[model samples]
Target: MSETLTLPSHLRAVRAAIADALGIDETEAVPEATLLGDLGAESIDLLDILFRIERATQVKITVADMADLLQGGIPDEEFGDENEVVNDTGLTHLEKVLPQFDRSQLTEPLTADGVLGLFTVRNLTDLLTERAAAAGADAA
Candidate 1:
């Protein structure tokens, strides 16, 4: 089942994550704020934002996934090869699963269509929550 996100709470975190990535104040971050113009993010900065979002949300998104997000939300089937590994950096026991695509390009600015074209941020958050719950259930 899909989990719903508390938009207020999620937005706050998302904004914070982006701010942290840009090394700026959260007050400067806003939904309408352009990562490039407002946040002073360049292409590399954008990739950093994506990684920050993944770290904050725990959803493993690939560069291909980001490109798909640029187009619109990706379907589960097109979510890329489920068999792919997710780089788990700094893990103790579990092997780290690296992202499928190149990390360098993640920071490029996504146009309105690019950003909105991807799955809604809420959907990405829910996907992460669902995975965590599934992992917890398996542990139990």
Candidate 2:
């Protein structure tokens, strides 16, 4: 018997948007996986993906939102030192925000740069879903 697909509607739409941004097949965009590592998305591709996601979901995702998520709700300046090295407290916050990644794989001296690697397809979907829900609530 052929099994019906059970992915959430928002997740499927987000996956398709990511696939289109990355120029990859939709089948390769797994929700639980990292976009940069698993899907071979470059840093430059992220802007395009974000634009596509916003258009597809009709949600306005701001740079501040991305920064807050990346910094675990902490201000960017507070998350690190002048050299951009993440302190212990920042590491703890990062662990909380990006639980999808293996913390053990992080470099000995973690920097803000490493956080970029933690963003996953699931994260994007979650952001879009949350924003869309909030927008719906505001409209209603």
TM per candidate comes to 0.44, 0.84
Candidate 2: the clashing residue pairs are none
User: Which prediction has the highest TM-score against the true structure?
Assistant: 2
Query: How would you encode candidate 2's per-residue C-alpha lDDT over 50-80 as one tens digit per residue?
Result: 7877787778876457667878667667888
Candidate 1 Cα errors over 4 Å, as ranges: 1-7, 72-140
For all candidates in order, the CA lDDT equals 0.48, 0.77
Q: For each candidate, C-alpha RMSD in Å? A: 13.3, 2.4
lDDT at residue 111 of model 2 (Cα atoms): 77
